[model samples]
Target: MKIGLYFGTFNPIHIGHLTIANHLAEHSDLDQVWFVVTPQSPFKKKSTLLDDHQRLEMVYRATKDYTKLRPSDIEFGLKQPNYTIDTLTYLEEKFPEYEFSLIMGEDNLKSFHKWKNYELILNNHNIYVYPRLSKGKIETQFNDHPKIHHVDAPIMELSSTFIRKSIKAGKNIRPMLPEHVWEYVDEMNFYK
Candidate 1:
């Protein structure tokens, strides 16, 4: 199976995340898109960040209805402050028959060269980049790189930070999240 890994903290999974993942799954050659819920970095703990399991639950609720989308908690067990290269390597070993690719925003692609062992990652897996409104010049080396594919997906400017802040401000951000996720957040009183 060809899988696209969409990694994020997903403090609270929202529509923007679902739109991009679903679009990639339906429009691209990928067989499925996995929302890889990233665990919080032990070194840089943020007060607003939910527990790893809580974030994963939100992801699961957001993606439960989509056949081509699912949630993954692979990074929860890994060491803190894990690198993409390390996760890719671990997934590759765990699922030898499956081809894994990365799903990232254009902004991340701009700084892709600075990632650890980026050359090795480029050589091993494909990178599917979606559009994002951000300021940065992409590395010249990646402009025409075969391993990197710039997918013409819809631009998603909504962010978890914005949602969290909105909730804290007593704004009805219910429309931003999946029904189950919204219920979960409401019940838990998260980000309030």
Candidate 2:
């Protein structure tokens, strides 16, 4: 089985996240799209992050109805500031029966070279990159680098950061998130 790993902090799982996953599962050949909830990302700011388990649970709740979209807490057991290469390697070794691929936005392509063991990840895994701003392209050195998989979900400018800011300010975010996600965020008092 082919699986696409859609890694994110999921600070608060929002509609854009769901839309991307839904589009990937609906259009791609992959069997499943797992939202791998990152405990901490090596490249992102750490101060504003929500609790790992809380974020994971929110993701799980938000995606419960979509059989094809599942939330993964694999990074919870891994080292702090988890890296993509490490997670991919671990998943590959742990689940040898499934072929794992990386799912990311086009913006990452420009900075992907900076990632640790980037070559190893490229050589080992297939990449499904969704089109984002300017639709970034790659000039890969490794023989089997990330392949671009154009996704056609609605172009959303709102990000988790933006959503968090709005929540903290007590601004209405009704349209930015799913109903279940909004309820969970409110119940948890996240970003407050």
Candidate 3:
């Protein structure tokens, strides 16, 4: 199976996330798109970021109905401040039968060269880049890289930070989230 790993903290999984993941799963050659819930870095004290499981639950609720999308908690057991290359290596060893690729935004692609062992990652795995309204120039080396595939997916400007701030301000941000995810966030009183 070919899986595109979509990594995020997903403090609260929202529509933007679902849209991109679903689009990639349906439009690209990928068999499935896994929402890899990134665990919070132990060194960073972020109160707004929900517990790993809580965020995972939100992801679960958001993607439950999508056949091509699933939630992954693989990073939760890894060392804190884990790098993508490390996770990719781990996943490759664990699931040797499957081909894994990365699903990232254009902005992330711009800073791709700075990542640890980026050359190794580029050589080993494919990177699916989606459009994002972000500032910065992409590295010239990646402009026509064979390993990187530019996916003409919709631009999602919505962010978890915006949702959190809206909820704290007593705004009804229900429309921004999936129905089940909204219920879960509301019930837990998260970001309020």
Candidate 4:
């Protein structure tokens, strides 16, 4: 199986996340796209993040309808400050038959060098980068790389931060999330 790992905090899964994953799964060579819910990203601040289980559940609810999309809690059990390289290595060993690729945005590629063992990741796996709304574009250095495939996915401006802020401000976020997810958020009173 050729799997594309789309890792994120998913502070709450929204339409933008789903659109990108759907586009990649349909257009790319990937057989499935796994939404790896990161409990705490090594580079991101942890203060504003929701509980790991909450985030995972949101992802599960948001992606449950897509046959090609899967929600994963793999990072939840990993070491604190979960590193992509370690997670990738473990997945490779555990699922030897599956070839894993990375799905990220052009924004992340801009600071790709800052990640741990980034070079090893580039050497061992393929990277499927999608366009982001604010990010300028992918750098020229990786634009032509054989291992890097730039996808022309729709640019969605919706973000989890924006959704959380809107919710706190008593604004409607129904347009940005799936119906089930919106109901789940309301029922759980999350992001309050």
Models, CA RMSD each: 1.8, 2.5, 1.8, 1.3
* Clash numbers, per candidate: 0, 0, 0, 0
lDDT of 3 by residue, 35-100 (tens): 999887543566767899999999999999999999999999998789999999999999999999
The candidate scoring highest on TM-score is 4
Q: Using Cα atoms with residue i matched to residue i, what is each candidate's TM-score against the true structure?
A: 0.94, 0.90, 0.95, 0.95
Q: What C-alpha lDDT, on a 0 to 100 scale, does residue 6 get in candidate 2? A: 94
lDDT of each: 0.90, 0.82, 0.91, 0.90
- Order of quality (lDDT): 3, 1, 4, 2
Ranking by TM-score, best first? 4, 3, 1, 2
On lDDT, the candidate that comes out on top is: 3
> For model 3, what is the error of residue 55's alpha carbon versus the real structure, in angstroms, after optimal superposition?
0.1
Off by over 4 Å in 1: 41-44, 134-140
Which candidate, 1 or 3, would have the higher lDDT against the true structure?
3
What would the per-residue lDDT of candidate 1 be over residues 1-192, giving only the tens digit for each residue?
Answer: 999999989988899999999999999999999999888754346666898899999999899999999999999888878999989999999999999999998878877888989999999999999988766545556979999899989988999889989999999999999999999999999998
Pairs in clash, predicted candidate 1? none
Q: Which ten residues in a row are the worst by lDDT in model 3?
A: 132-141
Q: Comparing 2 and 4 by lDDT, which wins?
A: 4
Tens-digit lDDT string for candidate 4 (1-192): 899999999988999999999999999899999999998876678988988898888889998899999999988788887789999998998899999999998888888888899989999999999888764655656777899988999988788999999999999889899888899999999888
lDDT assessment of candidate 4: 0.90
